[model samples]
Target: MSLDVDIGHASGRGPRDLNEDFAGAVRAQPGDRRQGLIAAVADGVSGGGLGLEAAQTTVMGLLSDYFATPPGWEPTVALDRLIRAQNAWLADHNRRRRGEGAALTTLTALALQGQTWTLAHVGDTRAWLLRQGEQGPELSLLTQDHALDHPDQRSRLTRAVGLDDGLRVDFAQGEAQVGDTLVLTSDGVHGVLRPTRLAELAAWGTADLAARALVQAALEAGGQDNASALVLRVQGLDPRQLHDEQAWGRTLPVPSPLRVGEALDGLTVTARVADTGVHLLYQVRAADGALGALKTLHPSRASDPQERDMLAHEAWLGRRLTEAEVPGVVRVWPRPAHASAFYLLFDWHQGRTLEQLMAGPGGPPRVADALTAALAWTRTLARLHRLGMVHRDLKPGNLHLGDDGQWRLLDLGVALSGQENAEQRALHAGTPSYMNPEQWEEGGQADAGSDLFALGVTLYQWLTGRLPFGELEPYPRGRHRREPVPASRLRPDVPIWLDRVLAKALAPQARQRFETAEELLLALERGASRPLQPARALPLLQRDPRAALQLALGLSLALNAVLLLWLALWR
Candidate 1:
């Protein structure tokens, strides 16, 4: 599929003696559909002697190297690797000229792959998304400010390329619609313009006019530094490109079961690890004797388009996720021209599942271990949420504690991406015990909030060795509501703050839960000192009529006794 875009950029020295801001956009060769488009903006640290050079080199290097990356590499991975190399080069160049200040700059890059947008950010420069809303076009900030929070030091960036020997960059990707507009700006521009005003400027005339107007707006608002703006208006996206792979997957027929000694596609099946009715998993050895996991749909689901599509979607997401804690796909075997079933191979992780580890000889994890796991999973979930995907089935069983002491989230069979259709939402996927209340209702869709609720349940179980809401009934029938008991009640070692956090996460109403995984993670890190407010609950009278009636009768009797005493005293 083709993605047509209208691009524009403008930069001005403003009040600065020399402009240190740079921006550029590059389109892939006309025949190279896979490389897609790249746009970047960089702002040099003004005090650095080589500020201008740093900004120019960063933007130019990124635009050039990103397109030169191998076609097979994902946009985020490619961009990150290129940026790191550029950072090292800049650092080396600065070291040679130690007499002068080191070259340092903030970089933000966006890559449009089909209808997906991948972002790499490492400084105060900002990226924003403007989408058509019911009221009007809405503006949403897409990058963190990456600067010190104190008022006097707010302009000082905490992270930037060439500033340090090693760099930690923020990477995110999400689906983009045809009408969406991606905007990138140096702090000189955004620092002076409010988000509302930026939205207005973004909508003016064409992309070129919009970019020029934004820079002018900044200059008019007392710009004190170099100002720059880059605007990309998504003119069109081909829907078929997004789903063609899935359509091909639906045509593959399920293969028959394999025996331990049988070989399929150069891999010898060694053992069957799991048979979950819907799918089958096998431990296999490649011809070279390397170990791997083979996953394929069950014969029963061979003709089912929905099942096939889910499998394809899972494979697609697995390939895109770059987090170490996310299980990586080793290779996806093509459906041979003659073969019926399709299978996916994954790097075999030789570690116990989190479920097994917790239930193993060690018993429930210590508070420290539980907290660590919670934080790790929270970060992983946050990444997934930012990518506009929800891991509907998040539980101990789907998590693997690698022998290397790393925990990786596994399985995406029921995961939902931003592009899912209504039919997929009504499919009733996910474990009921870990699902939020909304997931039980007809046509209820799971979002980041639902994922947080599942995380709370998972953490509760990990800490207390008990389910917060007890056993769950099957879907369409599991509508019962019950208050979650405090984890401290079962495990005295569980802290009150931790329990409160879980309680809020398990709140029956979606609105009562943490808005995002990042918030939940922050709360966990802060510990009991910052206690979460207890979730609102129904009054005792509404909760239990019998207890309310008993209390009312007791109060009435006491009132009658008091009246009689008063009357006798008066006589």
Candidate 2:
């Protein structure tokens, strides 16, 4: 792999685009042992202050290390060092400007060493891959982003190259193909353009032209922020690399002339998960001999190169997330590409999915599981949201209760970028029952808040044993109204304070919802320890740091309630 970079930036409506993008692709030195890397980036930050300086300094510091020691660099270690270096440099730079404080900017960087490349990012910047398509072209998101809203934090940039003294870098490596085009950009580029249009642009022109074109299109489409992009093509020698790259995206051998009873490894077909999507849930035991489920594509159907590639990619992503120790998630197991089929092997969890529990027979009248499940549900959602990956489909069916007493969130089959991305409209992958009104009213993509809203629905169902707006049928005309039933009605013992919190989380407007699951968790955690009042919960949602801190001790709630009672008696 070689290197190339082109930068495009302009002033925002505020007169300056604090956002600055820096791109660098350094060819490996003669003594270098690994394949060279192709790196590119675009970073946009609020306040326009030193956001540009922070971004520029990061790439400069990273490029220096990258070119200095390409001879012995592993993707994981290199990326971590790069992020640490960037964070340290930024911290020093901020201390110097203590009078002005720190300026925040999102970072997305790509380093390709040989046929393999790793991506590291924080905040709204993004990375994506595009390969040749049978219908022309298709692209997949490589980095899920480190934004305020997912795997579910809301304060923003839980990890970034320059957000704080420490940088929490999200990293991954994948095989790059001959014609594979990798793209990195600040939130502004895809934030304004649609995904199909972005893919079309990348497919139609050279890496340089396509990247610039996408940026230009975004600006034309009323892009309100500074924008940038780095686009690169994989070339040069390595026949073996081509095979490896081709194999990365295929897993399960699609059944062909081969007999059905013939086993691949050890999985036996038990049933199908989704017929159209080629998702097969197989019965098997993991290498550790633990009972597990295996999901793979049908071999005959996997014959379609593009579909097989996608399934393989999905499996790869699944495994990566799982290994990261990011809680409440499942990851794909890595197996060599074979038979042009893709499959994901999972540790069969003993307990049923939350969805199964929701509709199970209890003779109809609803009983509340909200209190029992609230902590795990909110905490689990909070952890993932902090990592910047939304579960998109977050109904009861997708949440699993493991026999080990740990709650597991499964099936990120439709995860998408929350930052600016062209494919925002293409995120039509959620169970309608749990989907928020934004899905039908605006065709809006899922965000951390959106996931939280769905979670509120799940929490409600678990508590009330009823759907939010009556039962949602199939996708034809799935309806979600603003009228959410009070948690008290279904489970009358439910505290008024807790009900208020749920109502805010499921607020119809995104802004009104608890900014992060952490916020809701904090309230819930505090409320769980004390008897909070309903009248006080709304203000609690709006309170400053000190009031919330005081409330957390369980002291303020009682005092405030007594004061209210006194005033009511006086009146």
Top lDDT prediction, candidate number: 1
RMSD of each candidate?
Answer: 21.8, 20.6
Clashes of each: 1, 30
Off by over 4 Å in 1: 1-242, 322-341, 475-482, 534-571
Lowest lDDT block of 10, candidate 1: 327-336
Q: lDDT of all predictions, in order shown?
A: 0.81, 0.63
Best by TM-score: 1
Give all TM-scores, in the order shown: 0.52, 0.49
Clashing pairs in 1: 253-340
Candidate 2 stretches with Cα past 4 Å from truth are 1-25, 28-247, 250-261, 266-277, 286-288, 298-310, 336-340, 362-369, 417-425, 472-481, 528-571
**lDDT for model 2, on a 0 to 1 scale?**
0.63
Superposed Cα deviation of residue 463, candidate 1 (Å): 1.6
- Tens digits of lDDT, candidate 2, 128-215: 8888868766898887766566544542665665567866777676766677877776677776777788788766566667766877
